[model samples]
Target: MDEETFNISMRKFLKKVGVTSQQEIEKAIRAGLANGRLKGDEKLPAKMVLTIGGVDLTFAV
Candidate 1:
């Protein structure tokens, strides 16, 4: 995913999960990684999920 879309989707998910800051998201992601819930080389959720603020660039031309 592009940097802008990744960040925007991350912020939205964080807010939905009750995280309000970058620190919180970072901490959560790190924890997930350590626990094997996330992977060291895997991409972020948005990259797989698709769409940001209703925009889906997967089909963009």
Candidate 2:
């Protein structure tokens, strides 16, 4: 595989994931607040799981 091509693709994928995830999270937070499910000062727990072929990783954010 070409290293430059692989790096570019990986960066694009990560950027898309980051932007979309942020938008969804913001929308969820707004909905929760509107419905009295979440207050404005709560520490929220978030997790992310990534799987690629035989590799799996989990991260807590």
lDDT (tens digit, per residue) of candidate 2 on 3-38: 999999999999998999999999999999999999
| Model 2: pairs clashing at backbone N, Cα or C within 3 Å | none
Best by TM-score: 2
Alpha-carbon local distance difference test for all models: 0.69, 0.88
Candidate 1 per-residue lDDT over residues 1-61, each given as its tens digit: 6999999998988677554455677888899999999878777754223344656455321
Tell me the lDDT of candidate 2: 0.88
Model 2 worst lDDT run, 10 consecutive residues: 52-61
Among the numbered candidates, top lDDT falls to 2
